[model samples]
Target: MTFLLGAASALQLPAYQALVPEIVPRKSITDAAALSSVGVNLARAVGPALAGLVIARLGVPFVFAANALSFALFLIVLLAWRGYQRPDTRVEPFIDATRAGIRYILHAGVVRRVLVQLACVMVPANALWALLPLIAAGPLRLSSSGYGLLLAAVGLGSVGGAFLMPAIRTRLGIGGTVAVASVIFGATSIALVLVPSLPVALAVLIVGGVAWIGVVTTLNGTVQSFLPAWVRSRGLAVYQLVLFGSTAVGSALAGAASSLFGVLPVMVAAGALTAVSAVLLAARPFPSLTGRDRAPMPSTDVPPVTEHDPALQGDVLVLVRWQVAAGHVRAFLTSMDALGHSRRRTGAREWTLHRDRDHPDTWAEVFRVGSWQEHIDQQTVRRTGDDAGIFSAVREHASDDPDIEYLITPDRTETPHV
Candidate 1:
């Protein structure tokens, strides 16, 4: 049952998140993300209490029946809803689309950093959830209802935190918000063990809840903002993979360590590690996303070749020659590094920069796309304002406009040497 539930969530989460940007305006995405969190936490606050009452008055079977009924209603609502209007763009094959998504993340430094930050916090933060039942049973010696109340407190606190997020984000920014929230959660974890009084633990959990929502909502929103529409769902799927994978690993480690070292020591270590991670994160914050345009602008010019053209069907290799200005080789290389990533992140299957052995000032930028169609898409469909800026910066170091060439292997012929 647990495995089945996990599989269901694996499908449900990414699809739900992908719909947010489609339904809401770009500026309201952060708020919409927070409201999604608010809904989950609100359910957390109410579900268990209701479940307990139903079990007490009716039975466990009745509680399950109610859950099934909720899902039925959800299906009905989904059936009635009209979906968002997507652009009439060419859709890649499923395998190709999946590969493109993976490639984007591989080349996107900002997204990688966000994922790393999330993992660092999530791995340790999971200790609270993994060990809370143990804490309730042993340290606090609470009854079932009391434990439910503790869960309710965390849920209620998260709901409150959602309302406070815009102000918090405005004040602290993404990095500071994550750092401070990490510290708060770490402190709460430490307090949960050291101060085992039921009342005190409940209070601490409330604070932990606030910190939890803050970190999650901020990071999730950051991912959503950074990802382009073409790969948003895939990126979120990867984010969810990291989030849940880290939780599983953390919970197992916490459980094992708690058995050997005792729950108190294990909790303390997790808390301390979480706080230390916060310090490390603050020292090296994520890159800012402000003022960057991610909207796709398709190329206006039509390609001469049709789909039936053999060259259009084969791999497309693009080569750009650059004559770097005197004494600007180093600066030029630095800018090209950014440009290379942009190429791969946009659509290039491979990208490389090479210098002419004979001519120190001359350089070559080489990239390949799956097909001519994809290369055409790279020109503007996958291009963004940020990519244009990078392109402009690279050009500033060049002595003259670089030469460009496109080549495609014929269907029955070998790839031609340059």
Candidate 2:
């Protein structure tokens, strides 16, 4: 039952998270992202104290029964939501889709940077949340209700932070917000280590909570902003994977370190590491998303396909031939390099660039996709409005419009029915 509940909780997270950007307008995404944290923080503030009271009065079994009923109510509410409709479009096979999602994240520079920062910040910052109960029991010598109160303090602080996030973000920008939040969180961690009394620790937690919400909401919004709708769900899945994975690992490591070296030393080390990481990451801050980044750039120029063409056709090859002046070869190649990333991130496989030996000014860019339909999806949905500059750069260096060709190998195994 425990395993079932855990799995259900994990599965529901990505689904709800993926729906946020789709439901909210693009202009208000940052605000929506911050407000989403508000809901979670509100729950944190209320749920624990309520749960403790219920457990005290009603017993563990009754609490579990109530939890099940709450889940059922949640399901009913989800079913009644009428805002979203899934499009009737062909999807790639599960394995292929997974591979493409991974490929996209690996190639996208901004996504990679965001993930790195998330991992660095989370690994150290999680110690406070994971070890607070231990601290209350060991150092502050608090009862269970006192520990619950400490948690409620953090939650209340988070709620306040969420309300304040928009103003903070407008003043500081995403990178600056994350940097400031990291430093604050690190400082709070150190303060928690030094503080002895229950009241002092609770005060530190409130500050820590604000910093926590600031960092997380900024990171979440940035990731959503960088991704187009086509890959948004998959990209967010990867983001959640990293966020949860790092926190879990960090908690375990912190626990072990505390056991060996004592709690204060481990926390001090973690806090210092988080602060240093913020400085290093801020040096090459994550890129902000422009309006173009959020809008899709569906191609209007893909050649018409007949019904005879199979959706599962293997390895559709694309060749783009460009004619550049001798002086422009370097510039053309540089632009093509950027274009290549766009292609790969969109689902292209086996991408390559080649120069003609006989005609020094002629260059050919080549790539393959798994199927004809996949290529069409790449043309229609995978490209983003941000790619216009990349396309224009390549065109600027070309003598004329580049020639494009699509090819596929014949499948010999199929025989038409007589």
Predicted structure with the largest lDDT when compared to the true one: 1
Model 1, 61-87: lDDT tens digits are 999989989989988987777885764
What is the C-alpha lDDT profile of model 2 across 85-194, one tens digit per residue? 77333567899988889989988998999899999999998888778888888888989888888888888788889888889988988888889999999998888878
Give the number of colliding residue pairs in candidate 1.
0
Report, for every candidate in turn, its global Cα lDDT versus the true structure. Answer: 0.85, 0.83
Superposition error at 54 for model 2 (Å): 3.2
In candidate 1, which residue ranges exceed 4 Å CA deviation? 1-4, 52-83, 87-89, 299-311, 413-418
TM-score of each: 0.91, 0.93
TM-score attained by model 2: 0.93
